[model samples]
Target: MIRWTSSRALPSVDDVILLAGFGLGLSLIVAIGAQNAFVLRQGVRREHVGVVVAVCAASDAVLYIVGGAGLGALVEAHPGFVTAARWAGAVVVIAYGALAARRALRGGEELVAATDGAVPDAGRRLRPVLLTALALTWLNPHVYLDTVVLQGALAASYGDDRWWFTAGAVLSSVVWFVALGYGARSAAPLLRRPGAWRVVDGVIALVMVAVAVSLVAGA
Candidate 1:
């Protein structure tokens, strides 16, 4: 059995556990990364933002459940699996970074025009966009490291309160995705400028490459 009771001046152990999970989840997921850049782009374009947000949040929830259920232990037991995933993920991210860098080099005008054209035809491209979003989420090795291995080990430490911790993490995912996807519209005015788009894409490219290099070096 788990307890949620708290004294007059202190939080209950369960409360502390939940807060910790939420903080950890937020810290990991809120970082600038490939998945986030994709979501922001789609959101700014007003193209399939709902689908993107739903998929990201749902995927996080599923991973959280898997981690809480001990997938982390399974992963730990297989060094070969980790090595393969790391290399594969690094390749994918590096490829993506190269694409982004190419686009950034094309200048802001091309980026703006492309975004504008995509917005009008967004409904026709939903399938491909969704597929890309899924790939971005599932192909990233860091997602597994943060959500599965790290969070799982942390949750396990909570013993009987692990489920509550997982719930908090899931909530954090829901909150962050919703905020990022929906709130991006407010930046439309700024992003309308070609220079702004170039800067954004350049930053995204750098982040992707940096993450890829770190993954390869760690492996």
Candidate 2:
């Protein structure tokens, strides 16, 4: 079992832990992935960006809480679980990367978002959009690795201040998702160009593959 330090060694709160959590959380969450891509797309299209952001942020918080509370300890106890998750995550990420690469090569022409304030008639309904957001957030095995296993283990290192670490991580998730979801609108004009979207997709594909490779190598 993973041993945590006693609360007696910690103050009521620690700024260092909080700052560390914030920085680490931001670094991990900022990576390019399907969730980020979907959020950006929804933001650019101006279709239920709020809902998508909320769902993502909330889901992350839950995962972080689970990790920080005790799941990290459980994960540390079971190396086999980590191995299984790593391989599974790699496979999923690779598949997603291939799809992204395909889109970059052949689907660029359909990348335009509705420029007007009004949602396009063909725009996805709220239910489907929310469901997609949930799927992308939860279905990705990397999420568990990053939030539950990695983040949890890291937080445990902080001893009694683990929850504070988690709070900072949660805050980072909220800030990042909100910015990515809302700030994406500013890039809408540029993304309207098929070439620009192609570039974005290509970058996403590269990122996905890189992450997958990293997981495999680390495992």
Which one wins on lDDT?
2
How does each model score on lDDT?
0.71, 0.74
Candidate 1 stretches greater than 4 Å from native? 1-10, 71-121, 187-219
Error of 1 at 60 (Å): 0.8
lDDT of candidate 1 at residue 58, scale 0 to 100? 98
Which residue pairs overlap in candidate 1's backbone? none
Score every model by TM-score: 0.61, 0.60
lDDT of 1 by residue, 1-219 (tens): 998876577788778668667766765675557787677778777788899999999999999999887843544565455555556656765666676677678864422332353353366577899898899889999899878866665565455577777888898899988887877667545655767756756765776666556556756
- Assess candidate 1 and give its lDDT: 0.71
Query: What is the TM-score of candidate 1?
Result: 0.61
Candidate 1: residue 7 Cα off by (Å): 13
lDDT of 2: 0.74
lDDT of 2 by residue, 1-219 (tens): 999987675443477667657755765676556787778777777788889999999999999999887844654676455566557756766776787688779854432434435343336689999899999989999899889876776566555567887898899999989987888778657655777757766776776677567557756
